[model samples]
Target: MSSHSTGTGKHHPVPKRYALLFACCLLLAIALLADFLWASSSNLSSSSHSSLNLSLDSSNEVVAVSVSTPPQPRSIKKKKEPKAVNRELMYLNATYADIPAPHWDWEEMPEAPVPRLDGFAIQLQNLFYVFAGYGSIDHVHSHVDIFNFTSNTWVGRFDMPKEMANSHLGMATDGRYIYAISGQYGPQCRKPTNRNFVLDTKTKQWSELPSLPVPRYAPATQLWRGRLHVMGGSKEDRHEPGLEHWSLAVKNGKALEAEWRVEVPISRGGPHRACIVANDKLLVIGGQEGDFMAKPGSPIFKCSRRHEVVYTDVYMLDDGNQWKQLPPMPKPNSHIESAWVIVNNSIIIVGGTTEKHPITKKMILVGEVFRFNLDNLEWSVIGRMPFRMKTTLVGFWDGWLYFTSGQRDRGPSDPSPKRVVGSTWRTKLHL
Candidate 1:
């Protein structure tokens, strides 16, 4: 019927057409795949692995995959360790449980008496300088007692023109001058110190400056970002406590005088307001809002742990000027004394008071040294203090932790227990 069609072939040209169509389709698919592979290869080179997958139906054995990629396996390159700004603290070297040079020896006094009464310590020229705090809790001290490390002796420094003591006065150093601001003579002081002054350790002179916007005592003053942060102390209000956080400009040779402005509401902010300029942030620790805020006029409340009446908590300031609460002190101490030093980026709390009553309890010591890591917000017990003592003032100097004599009401029920310790001890630990 046709031109003698080939064996088993009906319209052979149709098969030829189909073969040609299949070839072109296959060619088109190959071109598209090439483009896809080119684009994907660069992407894959940057990734951990490289591969391509496709399925095929070869019933007729005419259509089949023809990929030409040579298989290649992947390997990972090692990563580089990044650089750090501050010195690294390796915990394994957790060295230094500084006991007194002689544990059994309690000297009537140390060799060089630390020239300090109630004065706050300021670090200048790598040594601590004591400015006007009460020579005794009962006396007002107007003299500046400077402790020289190079000489390892005490020198009566020039006086702060506007000398302050016993007042909730705060001291802060800008690596050059020590600023002594607002405090009163007594804890019951009803009036705020309008007196604010700066002691230029460089020139050995005291200069008076503009006073605080409002008078407050027990304020936490610290130097942060080249500015001074003076935050939350008690300002007398009728029923509620006055609460606010402020930051100030403390630069020299300025057109105008130094001034402060409200930054945040301390009540709802980070770190309940035991702020220190540690790890480059305003670290606010354990705070409350009651008579503990005792506006010098109001009765000052003493320490009470179970009182749970006050907010016993801690918080840290983040980069965005935000607050993050930390795991609170296992047992909160109303005061920062011999215990609770921020060293090696860990809070070292040792030899604090756990007892509320002086007459009955007889110095219940919180001797455990709790080291807190700011990074993980974890607490660990390092060691115990040589003795469980409170009223202890702690300072860090040249790889040593030195604290002035700490004395508590030793004997219970003695209206005036004559147990005042006048000794200085340095820790053997080099943090």
Candidate 2:
């Protein structure tokens, strides 16, 4: 009673809500302490794993670790194309420094003894035997003009046999004898003759040989191993060209035996063949083909420049007696009657003709020059002539290429004034 009166009596019991709150607070403090201890253990474990990775890498081991990073986009690559080339510029710069162009020193040879066109020329020793061709507008010549390079003059002029006045004849020489085969004769040139003539150049004598099986104008004739091989020409007219190959046996290496037979029929046969024999191969170059010539009943006798397809097609006689085609000539040189010669085993082609206009069939003379090398099988334009020329006969002697007389602008039709030249142009071919 005394203690209660002097101080406050003993406290009463707590409320139920307050007692529940105190119990919850005590449980939360215990949970927080446990979480801190768990965090420390996880940190120590992570440091130990990183140390293990470093030790493995130093010991020359491979350790792959996967990371959860967002995937990155991949990059693509592209290809580049080649650039275009200029062909014309390439051609102009085709000249080589090592193989400098041929030192072309041209000189005018003595004027030919006679002016003619569509004739054939052969070189024997130092003499040139120019056979008969069209001498005048109305007639063909039978006169043989001999050009003596030794004497530097036309030493002699002889007449062919009265029956042998022919033009557009196929001629070949065997060093001593000249074999004159079929040709177009008479004033009208309508008469295609099969008369074969032989001339002993040494004896200055002429004799008849076995006639050709069929008469043709400008037959592709050449002497192969002493046998006369005649290929293609027009049978009736220049328009009707055939593909018959005829050969005759040479008796005593001079006279032609009577036997005449067809060797082979090849479609490569054409007119105005600039034929040459090199490396045991007979090469036939530009000529005329197809039925573009004046018709049989037409007013003209010879083929005119109308709808004619010039033969740029080349043919070579193989060892097996077959004709095989070679690479074609360049364009704009489709007309035949080009001057050609084999210089240093290279076929050098000179002036020719081409169509003057697309609509008009008339032809214009060209002075383009090109070289074909069999070694490389390539064609290149080497040089050009000083003046336009067509139907000019070409021959090679020593180091000079001789271009004999030919017509300038004259064609089959006599509409233009005749301009035949007798000049002999000599070009020094650089080997």
Residues forming the 10-long window of minimal summed lDDT in candidate 1: 89-98
TM-score, candidate 2, is 0.68
What local lDDT does model 2 show for residue 421?
76
Model 1 vs. true fold: TM: 0.60
lDDT tens digits, residues 1-431, model 1?
Answer: 66676667645345687889999999999999999998688666646443454544656444535454444445754566654421221111111112222232222214324333334566565466655543443445566656555555555556556445444466677777877767664432234564677777777866776767876655666767766666665564311344567666776512143566667655432111345667776666643343323333335422222221234367666572666777876554433422345677876654444423322322243444556687677766555444554444555656665555344433332212233353556565443
After superposing candidate 2 on the true structure, give the runs of residues whose Cα lies further than 4 Å from its correct spot: 1-105, 251-253, 290-306, 331-338, 409-418
Would you list the C-alpha lDDT of every candidate in the order shown?
0.51, 0.67
In lDDT terms, which candidate is top?
2
Residue lDDT tens for model 2, 1-431: 45554346667789999999999999999999999998778666655553222224666787765443332334644446444332221122111101123335567878887778777777787788887877665667788888766555777788998787467778777788888888777544465788888888888888888877778878777777657888887666556667888888785445546668778776666567666677878777767664334436756465444355565677888683778887876633422333676676689877665433332234556555668898775777676554556667776777667677777644422112247677777776664
Residue 18, candidate 1: alpha-carbon lDDT:
87
Which residue segments of model 1 deviate by more than 4 Å? Answer: 1-118, 163-165, 186-190, 237-241, 252-258, 268-274, 287-312, 337-342, 349-368, 386-391, 405-421
Best by TM-score: 2
Error of 1 at 127 (Å): 1.2
